[model samples]
Target: MLGILGLDELTERVYRELIHLGPSSVEALALRLSLDRDRVHRSVQMLEAKALASRNAVGQVQTAPPQLALGALLTAQRHALGQAELTAAALAEAYHSASTRSMHDLVEVAVGADQVRQRFEHIQLSAETELLALVQSTPEVVEPGQSFAEEEAVRRGVHYRVVIERPMLEEPGAMESVLGEVLGPERIRVVESVSTRVLIADRGTVMLPLTESPQVAEREGRRLDEVGEPMALVSRAPGLVTAMLGLFEYVWQRAVPVRLADDGLDAASADSAPTTLDLRILSLLLVGSTDAAIAKQLGLGLRTVQRRVAHMMELAGVTTRLQLGWQAHERGWLS
Candidate 1:
């Protein structure tokens, strides 16, 4: 563990035993630790060079106080890390600026996985109201349950409106990440499929991927096959953002809210609007079509049609199809 502080294993062991033994000679340390005297002597010398150990006139080695010595080492490491962070931030800004043709434009295309990941995280941290996203399985920057910024945003009470493609939550670490303390089922809905990955922060800005990148491919150890580098289009352009927002809504309505905390229909069913398929099925039923007929017309399985009809009946608190139709009319479901 002390290797990170520049202490080799033997050196750290020697120092720790020195502290325990309290003023041990090299010979005594070697005999007690079953190490050669010369190796113990060398480690003690190294410890002394680092000011972590001292020898008395009689050549008995003793460790420096643990608190003082380790605190100094840790503080120096932290300072170095802080400097590196600043340098990295500068480098990242340069990378992003280089990728964009004009920083003044409302929309700019940026290359590199790092830039895209940074924006993905930065938007979460910057959100003050709602944050919306459609997540996919691959080309992931932030792994599931690893988005610290998202956890912070959730803690800030920012409402999340997120949709995950059906396969995404089945991927490894996906359930833990999306269902971890950072996110709950209440904020997430499942879609049959989503082709594009998107993020809309506060509905004011949208980020969309444009291509796979060599940087990401190499990082993931995948063959690039001469594929173009990963790139993302970020936009604050009102028309583009609005169109993206509309698309999000369209998909969101068709998606099914999920709940696995208990055995029952999704609690979201109480508040969520009827899905597009649900509306189409209800419409066909009201027009006096049989379940099989509706199924064939909608390209759904016959059993799927029956199941949906039963679910609608439950939602309407009625046991019969006729009552369900009457309830649908009362609720303005056709509209």
Candidate 2:
């Protein structure tokens, strides 16, 4: 058989003898095989190199057990395997937690105007110590029963600081009166500009329309016409929440404190008047209401509104809506 594989017959014989007897000294092995001691020793060395056998000191030879350990090998393998499984489970858990945070931490679409109002109510109700808000209006365009919610929130003793457009201060209504009675003169601050509406609650959360097109309208009976996706250019990350909070601080710094009864003439007149048309255009822009809406609200033609806004933008030296809003506030025209 060894001849067919091209191996020496003595080499084959030594291999068979080692299998029958587990371990043996070189002299005993040589006596049993009837081969010279040197030849037996050489055969053992070849078997050991092939990993079929092993040698001990004092010239004893033994059959090498299988490379695989039974229980102990399995235990070591399982310990390594268990570590990998635990690591994978941890990574999966972390991914799931991050997905949940992304979904819950930011603004989302509310179903209806009523639903939007409800969300605002919920935010107001959830306030702990203070509420700082920047929006187009002071009283806010609340549905019928929201006043009760505001009253309930006020009763809880939350400090409310707000910045609003000048027209909202002039509007005659129970809503305006209610704000005056509750928040008092000290809490209300007003600024002027043309931009989208933004409302911040307790310096933690913010609400802004994500739509780039002004044509997209909140359809009747549909509160959420679209999703409130986070601004990609701006960091909505938690680490930058303080930066957004800083924006409110900057606006608050430039805003003027006022009471509904005060004519705002004192503040408005403190600086030289920017021509009546400039004041009108600047006021409309600050409220986040569009040019057409402002024209309709002020009873002017659309073209006139557009021309006036263009003129105001050129005069104010601002390139973007956000900057325009901030500039209008800084100039104290919206107040």
Candidate 2, residues 1-335: lDDT per residue as tens digits?
63433336777688778768867887888999887999998887776765666777756687765343223435655788899999999999999999887865553565444555666677778776676666654222453224565666677887777766555644334224535455542266567732545555666666544343212234233344353422312123554457667777888787655433333342123223355554654554554557766666545678877766665566678887678667776877645
CA error at residue 119 for candidate 2, angstroms: 3.7
Q: Global lDDT of each model? A: 0.75, 0.59
Candidate 2 weakest ten by summed lDDT: 227-236
TM-score quality measure for candidate 1: 0.45
RMSD in Å for all candidates = 23.3, 11.8
Best by TM-score: 1
Model 1, 44-70: lDDT tens digits are 989988889997888788888989988
Clashes of 1: 5
Model 1, residue 6: displacement in angstroms?
82
